[model samples]
Each structure stands twice: as structure tokens, then as C-alpha cells.
Target: MQAVNISGFRPITTSVPRSAPYPSSARWRLPMKSSSDYGSCDFSCRQPLRISSSFSAAAAYTSADGETTLIQSSVGISDLLIVGPGVLGRIIADLWKKDYPGSQVAGQTLTTDHHDDLRQLGIHPISSGSNVEKFPNVIFCAPPSRSADYIADIRSAAACWSGEGSFLFTSSSAIYDCGENRPCDEDSPAIPLGRSRRTDVLLNAEGAVLEAGGCVLRLAGLYKFDRGAHTYWLSKGSDENRPDHLVNLIHYEDAASLSVAILKKNLRSRIFMGCDNHPLSRQEIMDYVNKSRKFDKTFDKFTGTDGPLGKKLDNSKTREEIGWEPKYKSFPFFLGVNTD
Candidate 1:
């Protein structure tokens, strides 16, 4: 056995003789809690469990001479291909590696601009139009803005999958037509295709993935310390903000964890929602930020109130079905404002 240098981690590798036949099944499972225990367990509190499984499956590579070669590799949900590995995708990759150190993670980007940075994070970078191997597990995190045709891009990514594992598409909660601050869930009706262009794109993309037996994760407004709705509000300092409009949010890390959990579960043709389970008005968010004094800049008081009030998203069903919970329970929780 030889060690392969993957960023800071060294995953063991072994060379197999060409004469040996490839193994048929190479499935590996991560240590997961029972459905009842998952709700009580905190994903952040657990240590990364080491996998004792070895790669027995072979990958086929064709040479210039048209000679086919078999290469033995490790088996698990560990072999992941993330299409459009941006902020949320990167977090998901890092967290996935933390849990399964032997995992082989690759990210597909439009250009080679972030290739080096991705390598530094132990993720192999694959540029668009480049030849790549089929991955057992695939997640499409690319937004519609990145492509002229979002549905085609998603279908193409699905075609690249091995179909032996899970395929997940990250959709948006905005697709839900709950504009009156009504509670929305996985069963909530989405905006019909012709209604809103933005939501229509997402809804069409979700339909494509679902038609292909893939999972769809409709995520809420994603935020982190310096880049969430709060930061944007403080920077704008505008009076045109809608104070009464509600917003649901999820921390980037929590979204990432929930993604990995769903992928590990390997559910197909299912729709899941991700949110911090806290819906606050724009005014409420700003007020909390100002009172906490987390930032130096103070947001201007919102004066205008004539915009669509955002929906209140409830992912309780999502939590129970996936057996996962958001580590950052709410925006206030992430801000260190103890609600309890």
C-alpha cells in the first residue's frame, strides 16, 4: 500500500495487477445515527469517523492506443462530483472530506480561475468541456445565472452521473409562491412556470432533476458572518427597504451539512427544504443587528413597505425525513443573541 498526498490528508492507495478482475460491488456506508437519535445529535459536535473500508472497485481508462485498463479504487459515497463548487458547494466539500477523509471530491467550474484554490482545499478542479470520469455521487450547485440554459446544464450534469449513487440539485426556496408570509414546506405549491421568470427557471430545473430520479434541495437565503442579508442591509443604508417583508435564512455551514446528509442518505426523486426555521421581517433583522452591535455600521430605518412579503419556510418535515437538523438554529442564534 502507498499513501497519496491529498492536500494535508494522506489517503492510502494500492496498485492492482492488470490480470486481476475488477470487483463487482464496492459500496461503503458512513456511520450514521438512527432516525430517532439524529434529531438529538448535533452534526458539529461529532468527530469525523474514520472509514475502515478499502477500494475494491475498478475504474476503466482508455489509452491512446484504444487499450482499456482497469484501475482499482475505493468505494463509498466518498466519490463526489460537485458541479459549480462555489461558496455553499465548497463548504459541503470541506465538511464531506472531514467526515470521510478517503473521499475523492471534484468540483466543476466554468474556468480554471479557481483551480489552484480548489486544489488547496483538496478538491480536484474540472473545467467545463473537459473530459472527466463519471462519479457515483453528484451534486449540482450551479445557479441559473451561471448558464444561459439552466435546465440543460442540470440535465447534462445528470448524464455524467454513474447512476449507482445519489444526484442532488440545489434549488431555491423562492420557487415557492408564498409571497404573503404564509408558511411553506416541501409540499407547498411552487410558482407556475409562466408566472415569475426567476422562480420559473428554478422550478423547471427542479422538474428536470426530479424527472431524472434525482433529489431537489430548496435552500433559503444563505448567509454567513460577513455576507448575509444583514451585511447587505447595513452596507446599503437605504430607506427604500421593506421593513414588514419577511425572510427565511440558513447559515452556509448548516446548508452544507444538510446537503451531505441528504447525499449520504441517497434518496432519489425527493424534495427537501433547508432553512434556519426562523422567519423575521426586514425590520426585525436590522433591529437585532443594530442592538447586538456586531457591526460598526448602523442600518438606516426602512421607510418604504410596499413590496412582496417573503414566505415563512418550515423545514420540520425536511428535518424529520432526512434525520438532520441545522446546527445554526436561527439567524439570532448565529448572531450570538441567545433567544433561550
Candidate 2:
């Protein structure tokens, strides 16, 4: 990828290459965890970049020699649109609007259940039959369950988008087929699931976004505000299959803020693995959640199932590029927060 300049900031480019297909493997199970939870670009932000008030804003003062000085000017940008405004989408939309008041924010959803809610929040609802309009920023958070057609829709809209900033698509890290317990980055070999409709659809979606020169975020599991895979499992007494496998997670608020930061910064990294800095084994998480929540839910240990497929997702590059770090560092830490 080549480097380019945008608004005086250097942006790095990102690209994904085609790889030979691999045979299908057994579906990896969500290990029983205690219930832990958890950029570059020359683009202008929604508002002028402001330094901390504690710092003096003056560029410089004349010394013995009367020399004129200058302080760097901050940049700002335009509006945004979000496709598939689900839970995460809603949070993103709210945060985006909060950060960019008077910024035209549009939202597209498959249903109208939340139309009133979105309208109250000042997000303009977009219908499927509506004419395509481009904005300076765009985010696609559609699910793979919508099928490959969902991907096609994003590609079509992105192709016609008038924005020069960036397009970001949220994808799952399950694309990586790691069986051994090791960390995987954006360059790691992705898992190939032959004949699996869901896997095929998601992979195709990622390819479509990348091909469009847009950003593809491979996010780890998400948990926040009484919702999460671990919470569901604990409530259902789900079996603990992979006690040793590590689980990568990010808080809902953190994910939303991170995406906003990327767009505001107009970063160039095409592919990013989004996760918290810490990775915990299933057993450790389960114990922490069960103890913290006082649930004490028990899970059955496994023996013969090819030892559970596990992997660690690294998000250092993503953090470095975006210049944002997660507010919640680990699932346990998140749960321990005092709501009061």
C-alpha cells in the first residue's frame, strides 16, 4: 500500500489479497467463560482539533530577534451515514451526532421498530427504495445473516458514495481459522470454511469492502450493558467446552468510540483486528463472571473434542493507527464497575 496526504496528514493505505480456499473445519464453539466481557489519515474531524486547555495555544513569542510565528491550524470535515443501525449502530449514531452537531446523519435499517427512536435521536431514517446519496463518512454494520446480498448492497452504495474520507465495515474475527493458541494480526491467514454459507458470505463481504478501498474491522466478541455471549451462556447454563481457549472481547462503548475516532481521523489502515489489549482463557473469564455476578454457574469440562479451537487477536496496530485505546481494558474489569 502507498502513502498519501490528506489535509496535511499522511494516511497509510490497506489492501487484502486473494488466498487459496481451504477445506472446512468443525465449527468452533464459544468456550464457557465466567462472563467476562469486554489511523491515520489526513481527513478532517467533525470539529477543529483542539489541544488540552491546560496547554498554551500560542505558537511562539518573539525572542531577541522579532520573528513571526505560527500555530498549526486544525482541520474539520462533514457528515456521515450508517447502514444497518442495530444496537452497535444506534450507539455509533448517537455518539457520532454528539460529536458532530448539525452534522447530517442518516441511518438505514431493515426494520422500522426503532424508527421512532432513531427519529427522536435526530437520525434520518433511510428506506431501501430511497435514492442513493453519499456522505463524507459511511459505516456498514450489517450482519452476515442477511446473506451475501447484504455485502452486495454495501459494495454498490460504497461504489457510488461521494465521500472522499473513508468507509468502514464491522466484521467478525471468526474469519481467522487458528487452532493453536497464538496471537493473530491483520496479516494472519484467515480461516476458510468450504461449503459453509455463513462463512462464505462473511468472507465475501470483507473482500467486497476491501476491494472498494474501504476499511474492514475484524472485531472480537462484544459485551456491554447487560448484553453479551457470556451473559447469555451464564443465564442458560451453557457447557464449558474450551476451558483453555482465550477469548477476545471489546466493550460496546469502546467499539463505538473507536469507530468514531477512526472516521474523525480519516485513517488509512484497511484491515484492523479490534479487541482489548488483554486476552483471557475461557476458564478464567467464567470464574470471574460467575464469582463477580454471584451466579456460581457450573459448566461441564470437555475431554475429546480436538481440544477446542482457540486464538488470540492482536489490536496493537489498530490502536496505534487510530490513536485511541479502549476505556475498559478487560472483561473482568468492566464487570467490576460500580453502576451506582
lDDT of 1 by residue, 31-105 (tens): 222222212111111222233345556565333333333333343446788999999999999998898887778
Flag regions of model 1 displaced more than 4 Å: 1-77
lDDT, residue 227, model 2? 81
Candidate 2 wrong stretches, greater than 4 Å: 1-77, 193-196, 294-307, 337-340
Give lDDT: candidate 2, residue 67.
28
TM-score of the candidate numbered 1?
0.78
lDDT of each: 0.70, 0.60
Among all windows of 10 consecutive residues in model 2, the one with the lowest summed lDDT is 33-42
In candidate 2, what are the lDDT values of residues 219-310, reduced to their tens digit?
Answer: 88888847886766566565547567778899988888888887776543266777896777776676667657545565433233446657
What C-alpha lDDT does candidate 1 achieve relative to the native structure? 0.70
